[model samples]
Target: MRIAMWSGPRNLSTAMMYSFGARADFTAMDEPFYAAYLKATGLDHPMRDAVLAAQEQDPALVPLGFVQDGTRHLYMKHMAQHMIDGFPLDWAEDCVNIHLIRHPARVIASYAEKREAPRLADIGFDRQLMLFERLGGLVTDSADIRADPEGMLRRLCAAIDLPFDPAMLHWPAGPRAEDGVWAPHWYGAIHRSTGFAGPEGELPELKGAEAEVLEAAMPYYERLFAERLKNS
Candidate 1:
């Protein structure tokens, strides 16, 4: 089974990827569209040149298949914003899509630390919601996963009719071969841990442009949050 896990940056996406990567039956893929996104927008993201050279810049040629002999499931970690309007999403039609969301305040706070003065588009809440509307898939909240990793994962697996794998609960700390070239800039928090961080505390404070972004993104996040899997 192929699981296309869609999420924005700084939302524990890497950790979740690691959790699934720990499974012997699954092969985790870093952002498959990063280079293509960068090439399409020509936005000067960190490690722009390196990213351009590391992965396929042509969205059409990007591989979406498992590479390992025993790999039974391919878990793709996708950034919602990377999918430009004209980019192809037909590849997702055959996969079990999952939307992973986080609070806007938390997203902006975490994202601003890496890219200053983030805009509404940068956080990708609107884009995430758009994709959800189009793809119509299961939703999971990062906060819920952090509160109870094992329980939430079991719920996730059951929701998809997949057996719960305790192996997803923990993984070797530090980077993996599947990490994207941009790992250095955005993966520090995840790299230092072996598993999901504990439950989040109070939302971070923001001001100026960042605060405005939070306000704009809150509605989108709330809409998606309402659909998130309950803590049953």
Candidate 2:
């Protein structure tokens, strides 16, 4: 079995990857197409040169050869926006998929701290909704996972037809080999975390165009949020 966990920036994607990596039965992959995305768009992200140099520049490489050496039950952590304009996506249908969403307000605030002014596309909410509509799979919210890790994760596993492993609730405090080359720039908080933290306090206000982007993304977020796995 293979799982493609589709998520946007500033979501709990890395943590979810760590959780799955902790499981003895699973092999986790971190944003395998990131290098390809960078190479294709030439987005000047932090460590742009380093990220492009670290992995295969081919977008199809990861999904096409996902389970190298017959590794069963691989978990792939992916950013939806990484599926660029020219990339082929027919390969995605081969894996069970899940969309991980966070509130646009929270995402924008967190993302702005790392990079310059962000548009809605930078956060990948639009791409996530597009993939969700086309692929038709499970949806999980970062808030839901943060609020109730075990319950929400169990629901996720059940939804995807996998058994819930207790290891998914915790992981060691350190990085693993599967982390993307950009880990140093973006993974500090999650690297320090051993388990899911509680829901964060309300984020500060969005300013000007940031506010407009959040407003535009809310309906798409609400649409996915409605289908999130219930803990009960």
Which candidate wins on lDDT? 1
TM-score, one value per model: 0.96, 0.96
lDDT of 1: 0.88
> TM-score of predicted model 1?
0.96
What's every prediction's RMSD, in angstroms? 1.3, 1.3
Screening candidate 2 with a backbone cut-off below 3 angstroms (N, C-alpha, C), the clashing residue pairs are none
- For candidate 2, give the lDDT: 0.87
lDDT of 1 by residue, 49-142 (tens): 9999999898887854434446478899999989879898887887789999999888888887898778887778899999999989899999
Give the candidate number with the greatest TM-score.
1
Over 58-144, each residue of candidate 2 has an lDDT whose tens digit, in order, gives 876756657743655788999998887778778788878899999989988889898876887788888888999988889988988
Task: Give the residue spans of candidate 1 off by over 4 A.
Answer: 63-71
